[model samples]
Target: MISILFAVLTALSNGTASVLQRRAAADAPEEDALRLSLLRDLLRKGIWIGGIAMSAVAAVCQAVALATGPIAIVQPIFVIELPFTLLLGGLLFHGSFPRSVWLAVAAVAGGLSLFLLAAAPSGGDASVTTGFWPEALLVTGLFLAALLAVGLRVRGNARAATLGLAAACGYALTAATMKDAMARLDHGVGAFFTGWQLYATAAIGAGSLFVLQNALQAGSLAASQPMLSIGDALISTCYGVTLFSESLRTGWWLVPQLAALALVLAGCIGLSRSPLADGLAPRPDDRPRTDVPAAV
Candidate 1:
């Protein structure tokens, strides 16, 4: 129960942070998007600072949740972050929250509950084999590099969605690595530093932030949020099963799980179309202009 509570709190913190961070990043001076210049500019914004603080809180809460619960259980719970973002973003922007969005939120809640209860994920090892480490690192690194390359080549909503998915992949890999490193805390602080997962988590986390900033800068929240939410859920589930050796109910139970996935997807789609999501995008006048003045 404590783990569940912490996961929920983590979702709240992360959701609110997304809105704050994007607001600051969107207002930053035009530059190479997601470059150090944009980051330096956003660092001066109070809202961005508050967003970073919230993200830190979320990370702490997530670590606590992971320590106490299976990765499958803790990570899937983060799907609620999208709905929470819609709620908080609406409140922050004074936008009217729609009934359909609430219905979608309720569907997500019910679907997650039904899916988790049916799946009953269990069994995980605290330590990964040495050989597995190289494989895991290589696969994740290749995937992220491909995603970044493709995302950087796009523009507008497509760019946002692609970069958001890349961020999601980074976040999923980070969570898996973080779980591995945190498990070493049982041995002592020295053990944690000795583990390569700790370093990988830091590197991936920094990359995720860079990708996320570009995602936000590329387009509206609607373009990024659904991709980020859905991609994280899918990748994290695979990581939990593969890396942690966690098991979910198979055979007959797969049907309900599939249905639950459909429900979650539907909810995410609905919320992405909400007024609150629209508000998250910069106003037309606020967008960076590329038009040069007419030659005098």
Candidate 2:
């Protein structure tokens, strides 16, 4: 239960960060995408910095959640971030959502709840076996590379979706490594520091952030958020099962899980089609008054 609570916090923090970062990324020059210059430009924006701060908070919460519970349980909770992002975007941008958006949000929530209830993921080892690392890393690396190649070749929504999925994979790998590193803490401080997984987590997380920025820059949140949220959840579930040996309800339970996934997919499609997903406009009163004199 504590893990679930922390996972929710992680989702909240991540949702807020996504909105802020999306705002900043939308204004960035297209030429800067997938380049270091993108981050350099973002660093100059107060909003982007704020987003990074929130991401740091999310990382802390996620670490605690992963350390305490099965990654399958902790990671899937992040699917709520999609709805949270939409809701937060409305509030921050002074926009209102319609009834359809509300219904879609409900569907996403309900589906996630159903899936978790049906799957009942549990009983994972704290640390992954050493032998699994090389194969996992190699496969993950190739998958990311292929995605990045496709992302670079595409434009608009396609580019955004491709890059978003790539980023999701990177994030899943980061979580897996982070969990492995955290397990080292049980041994000693020296073990935690010496563990290669700690370094791997840091490297992978930073790369994921870079890819996410590119995704935001390529198109509207409507095009990318679903891929990011859903891909991460599914990929992390695989990592939990294969690497950590987590258990889930099987046999007839798969029926409910598939149905729940369809519900979530439908909700995602609905939310993506809503006007709010394209970026909400500020209320008339919230707009800057150009008629006002400068303070200087």
Best by lDDT: 2
Candidate 1 per-residue lDDT over residues 1-296, each given as its tens digit: 88789989988898989999888777764455868887878887788999999999999998888888878888888899998887887877666777998998998888888889889888887656566778877898898889889877778889889999999998998888888899999999999999888998888888898889888878888888778877887898888898889999999999999899889888888888888788775677755566966343
TM-score of candidate 2 against the unseen true structure: 0.95
* Number of backbone collisions per candidate: 0, 0
* Model 2 regions lying over 4 Å from their true place: 280-296
lDDT of each: 0.84, 0.92
Using alpha carbons, what is the TM-score of model 1?
A: 0.93
lDDT (10s digit) by residue, model 2, range 172-225: 999999999999999999999999999999999999999999999998888889
Candidate 1 C-alpha RMSD relative to the actual structure: 4.1
Native-referenced Cα lDDT, model 1? 0.84
Off by over 4 Å in 1: 284-296
